[model samples]
Target: KFEQANGGTILLDEISEMDQGLQAKLLRVLQEQQVERVGGRKIINLDVRILATTNRKLEEYVAENKFREDLYYRLNVFPLQWLPLRERIADIVPLAQRLLAKYSRKMNRTAVSMSDEAQRVLQAHPWPGNVRELDNIIQRSLILQQGALIGPGDLHIQPGSMHTAEMAGRINSVGVSQADNSQLGNDMKQHEFQLIVDTLRETGGSRKDAADKLGISPRTLRYKLAKMREAGIDLDAELKG
Candidate 1:
């Protein structure tokens, strides 16, 4: 990959997960800006700009001796902290708009757009999975959308997942009360809650199978199940033995 990105850039995502052996090799490569192929006598030079990203705090990893300290400093040059998609509510709609156009062209759909209500829904979602999750939602919604405009009903997000920005947005735009907001939040979650329960039953209470069917991570499914448990929904009584 470094040889291929000779004059451009290479992104090493999830850098914190790299093993110690690989970290040593990467440190050497960064210092030398060169590489050699396995069981070969040829030395290849590189001019690639290295970019790395991690969802973890590297300093903590380094302090714990999980990551190399020298490599951490080497790669920390010009570092940028990316706020989560839920925090960057301002970027949500614009990013969605661009993604919509891109997907529309790829899918051979003509000039699809988002409705005002749909935009509001997009803004409201907590985006637990971040932009990748947002990408999934938009792509799925495009298929569900029947017309040029993507409406709130077309969106796949659980209705009850609320963000602070969403609450502010609602108050400013619709003059909705806190009480009304609570009701909307509660009602929206029922659909998602039921779907999960039904899927669990069909999978014979196998969460992994249900997660695979639902297109969510097992961890996410576990979290959802925890929420249901908190809501006093007794799933144990209903699941197949």
Candidate 2:
């Protein structure tokens, strides 16, 4: 398959989570530009460009012997670090607008725009989950929005209670009622839990399908469900329905 991708790019996302044996195999492939398939003797040449991404610090993994040092060096030839959304405040509105357009089209919803108040709320967000979180929020907001404009009320941005003091001040400046913000924060988790349950139902209890519809990985969905179970949420009963 790597050989078939000759003259193209192959992205290995979350490379740090890959198995150590697989890392050694990949290192060999990179060094030799060829791969031997399982149960096959012929070596197939590959001329594919490899791009890998990981949120973890590879150097730390190397120190812990969880990641191969040679593989890390090979993948780090041209490293690019993207700042979290909270730090790139200037990009928030533009990214939000782009995402809104994208997901609206995807969901067959009206081409909607964000209200000034909603934009302010987004800019004030701590964005602990970064771009992916923002994307999910936008998609959810689109589903909840009734009009052509998405208001702050439509957003289900979770972990809202963890907002910075500056963000709280900004929310206040936007004339968002404290009661409303507090209620939203309180309802956020239940809303997310319900969303997951509904997606699972829609996908007939298939975790992979539900994750695909929710724009998240099955591993992420499993981890979230595990946390919910740890918190005493009755997932088994909810999922059975």
Candidate 3:
């Protein structure tokens, strides 16, 4: 693979997780610039650029003798450390919006736009899981939300290190109430139903347009309308022109 990517880059993510034996092998490959395939006698020369990332402090690992000093030196020729999400507050909203757009297209949902309140909630998060966490939150919200606009109620943010008791108090001060675990399911269902109705109203009872706005399929909207009719919600009467 290195030979194939001779002029390109090979990224080794989470390099700290590599075992000592594998580290030694990697060091030999980097130093020698050649590799011998298993059961093959010919050694192939490599001209690939190597890039690696590690969440842990490699210097600490080196001091503890958990990582090979020689290998560390070879790989640490140029190092760039990324600040955690909590520290990079400016990036949170842009990153979230980008991910939202990506997952929206992938899931075949309408282009979901973020509400200012939702953006605030996202910005408040500490993001212990970093970009991966933001990605998951956007994906989950896209799945749960039933409106063109994603609001704070649509997000299910877990409390993190930065979300301390003081932060909770601050959130409450801003009129954002955290739901009790027991009531969360019912509350979410109510929100989803309301969002669906609002979208239908906005689109003048056009189910396809409403479904597009709600990030759901037209068939799904029909099924939901059917259920609402059975539940005496009278959506048809309400939506009639």
lDDT of 3 by residue, 113-180 (tens): 99999999988887877776777567657656757998886666756642222121211121112223
TM-scores of all predicted structures: 0.64, 0.65, 0.63
Which tens-of-lDDT digit does each residue in 216-241 have in candidate 1? 68998898778666666667764532
- State each model's CA lDDT, in order: 0.72, 0.72, 0.71
**Which has the higher lDDT value, candidate number 1 or candidate number 2?**
1
lDDT per residue for candidate 2 within 165-206, as digits (tens), equals 222122112221112333333333334556666667667899
* Clashing residue pairs in candidate 3 (N, C-alpha, C atoms within 3 angstroms): none
Alpha-carbon RMSD of each model: 13.5, 13.2, 13.9
Give the RMSD in angstroms, all C-alphas superposed, for model 3: 13.9
Superposition error at 232 for model 2 (Å)? 29
Which runs in model 3 stand beyond 4 Å of their true positions? 161-241
The true-versus-predicted C-alpha distance at residue 220 of model 2, in Å, is 29
